[model samples]
Target chain A: MISEDYDRIDATLRSTLRDVLGLSETRAAALDADTPLFGAMPELDSMAVAGLLTEIEERLGILIEDDEIDGEMLESYGALVRFVATKTRR
Target chain B: MLRFGPDQGPLVAVALPLFEDANRVRGFAVAICRALAARGVATVLPDLPGQGESLVPLENCGILDIADGFDCATKEAWNANRRLYGVALRSGALLDKLALLDGRWHFAPQDGPSVLRDLKRIKQASQPHIRLSDADWYFDLQAPADHPDPPVEIAGNLISTALLTDLSVYAPWTPADGGPVRIVRLDSDPAPADRHVPGTALWRRAEPGNDVTLARLLADDIADWIATCER
Candidate 1:
């Protein structure tokens, strides 16, 4: 099981996705650690990536470099959550 | 569509349109002009090169050419006694990052990489992107501009390699050292401007999305903000 902190992060991530990607709350809640992004989610297009990063930066209070982003980090929900976790820890 | 009030008031030159129709909020740029006119604010809506009624060919246009249009739009405001304010929507907000710096409102400005990447994805082309300079970028191309076939269309916009090279590496947002930027982050901020009621994505392309009430509220909010800032 994930820690309570991760649960909160996941919750926050869900809300960010909803706001940036325009996903519904019900659709957002269904997403889990293994949920694939980019290809799987039609709404998370190239333009949405910019919007997503902006929202993530504001919501998590972390700064992400353009070079730091890769397909792997956005490959799955867990990958994104871990990325945020690592950034927050730093 | 350049709009001015009866009395000579502060002018808002909208630059760097987020999408095709600049200043289009629920088909309300004209409505916004009227609204701002009532509030004593003159507004100028300058069309990008190769856009709207402009006769410039789409393939001949570049980002610098677009910025030129922005410059001409704000010239009248610059000469005036009162300070000229700029309003850049979405990625167009990058205009504030450039030479055009007046009191401004940036409604969710987008970065350059995001724009380039989005351009690539819309065409479903997975070519590599290379950044040449701060405001230049390169995308891998299959052929030169004078290729056999005509210019290809991507995302409802005709584009060529020359255009792509010019639009490649624009990173507008920097660390705000108390600069002249006021971004109303619609996604993060709890302000009324960012409110997202269900089935109400006004910026959605597939659906006919128009929220008249919210548009009015947002226009009012923008007017109030500009009025306060100009004061």
Candidate 2:
């Protein structure tokens, strides 16, 4: 079974990248929170970004409006998780 | 039809294949089957009529007919032993009867209307270089009897208008009447679920290629579920 840490936001985020972007566990974990995702990761192109957004909704059980996600929100893992946490709390 | 794992125990009935990009679906099925085999479970991945190396022409097939084909395959597997389970993915989930098996595992099941909408969108997106003389067949999701023949282009495959029309109206056949459904939606699955949600939709990764890592993960997930079900 894949190792899982459900409590940590970074753990969840990394796992999400592993599943969505098909990254290895090491590769996903290697990504720092400040690491840019949108423009940096070729896999995170426009379509992949849209998919990642929808997946964030499904995985977190939260609704994310289209207007809520901009390039800035996806700039880094920290930014994306912060946006998710805020939306989920709201 | 492809067989995987040890064929001794309950056979998994894989039904209602992806209408488009049959190869990608086939690849995932192979992975899932191997995973199941590792857990000592077997699966029968039937090539949907007229697709996936099937000799039948698309014009000769329809929605209900394909569902019936699934039934035949499922029953065949069950007949081998009195036990049966099911795994349906994406548009394949339209075959609700897969739920009737001893255990049910579903991934990203879409409703008929939504699938039709996506097809229409793809057709529209592939504009300017429209292939058909009477392109309404693409827009309306129907193949008029008079509007030419089989082998129309869709999602990188040549399909029949009759089959496409049948798919356009394909109804949502939920497994509500059967066992508890384990749902994992990576794509636009209209169905609800019970825990174990994946954080990504890798079914059709937009890199214009298949996602092997996610595919393996899903196979492991399904195999784990099958092992649990057997226990």
Per-model TM-score, in order, reads: 0.64, 0.61
The DockQ assigned to candidate 2 is: 0.13
lDDT of 1 by residue, B30-69 (tens): 5555666766677776766666666777666666666676
- The parts of candidate 1 lying over 4 Å away from their true place are A1-5, A33-90, B2-7, B16-35, B76-83, B96-102, B123-153, B160-163, B166-181, B187-231
Give the number of the best model, judged by DockQ: 1
- Expressed as tens digits, the lDDT of each residue in B97-199 for candidate 2 is 5334777677776656555544544553455244433334553346576766555565565555566676667755545655646777653233466544433
Per model, kept true contacts as a fraction are 0.05, 0.16
Pairs that collide, model 1: B16-B92, B136-B169, B137-B168
Which candidate number maximizes lDDT?
A: 2
* Candidate 1 lDDT by residue in tens digits, A1-90: 358768767887898888667788899999988999978899887756765775676567677765676789999998999998888777
Q: What C-alpha lDDT, on a 0 to 100 scale, does residue A29 get in candidate 2?
A: 78
